[model samples]
Target: MTKSYVVRYVGGPLDGRVDTLPDLPDEPRSTVTHVHLHEGPKIVHHYDLCYAVEYGCEYRLRADADAE
Candidate 1:
């Protein structure tokens, strides 16, 4: 079975959202991109990896890219 990890998103519109991702490499991507689609156009949010926790990792939304 493949191992998965839980990712907690903090700040921005996606704050408090938790996602399950596949096994990550020793050095995971510094940032994660999320495409959000609501009623209108799609907005992209970039989250930077903060630190590792017991179960998985936590990512914070980048300030520069937090405009809605």
Candidate 2:
């Protein structure tokens, strides 16, 4: 099975967004991650484009799960 990575929004304007991706690059540029949020107990997946900073930003990059 293939592993996937996801970005969990902890703060900022893109809060409450959990996006999944197959792989994330280590370049200094902007990448889009699908933002998923729930409203009124309804699961809403917002394919919102979010800018990720490699140097300075409130967002961060980390492993979605343990790789085996």
Candidate 3:
């Protein structure tokens, strides 16, 4: 099984506390970690880096998130 997670980041004018959601950037600020999970178990393995979006453009923003 494969799942996707939206990587949230705290940068730009919004630092310290996160009271509102941040806007997406224009280029990749960090490595985007894709993952794959087995059917028998819920454990997931780190897959690859999504360098570009569907439109072939790179997103610019650091993603700070840990899997649960």
Candidate 4:
């Protein structure tokens, strides 16, 4: 199976520095294995996009779909 996702810093200046969206992890488990993607989400984004998947968290991503 395939999935979409993104990765971002835990909490820093680059925090929420989304760009790598729609990442298909080799296996989506409690811990991610790899993240070999860095592109915008597959949607009409407006502002910025990012995701967080660390420190006891799931693959939560953010995008600006409001923009066209």
- lDDT for each residue of candidate 4 in 1-68, tens digit (9 for 90 to 100): 55545554333234455445466556544432233334864332222223333532333333325545
lDDT per residue for candidate 1 within 1-68, as digits (tens), equals: 88787888898888999888787767878899989899999988899998766646788889883355
TM-score of candidate 1 to 2 decimals: 0.62
* Residue pairs with clashing backbones, model 2: none
Q: How close is candidate 3 to the true structure, as a TM-score?
A: 0.21
Per-residue lDDT tens digits for candidate 3, residues 1-68, read: 44333443233222222222243445534443334356775542222223445423332334435723
Which candidate should be chosen as best, given TM-score against the real structure? Answer: 1
Backbone clashes in each candidate structure, one number apiece?
A: 0, 0, 4, 1
- Candidate 1's displacement at residue 52, Å, is 5.8
**Residue 41 of model 2: what lDDT?**
57
Better of 3 and 4 by lDDT: 4
Q: After superposition, how far is residue 54 of candidate 4 from its true place, in Å?
A: 12
Residue 21 alpha-carbon offset, candidate 4, angstroms: 3.3
Residue pairs with clashing backbones, model 1: none
> What's the true lDDT of residue 23 in model 3?
39
CA RMSD per model (angstroms): 3.8, 12.8, 15.2, 13.4
Q: What is the per-residue lDDT of model 2 for residues 1-68, given as tens digits with 9 covering 90 to 100?
A: 87665555644446665767686646523433434565655432223234456312324333344544
Whichever of 3 and 4 has more TM-score, that candidate is: 4
Candidate 4 residue-wise lDDT at 33 = 28
Cα error, residue 66 of model 2, in Å, equals: 38
Q: Which ten residues in a row have the lowest lDDT in candidate 4?
A: 43-52
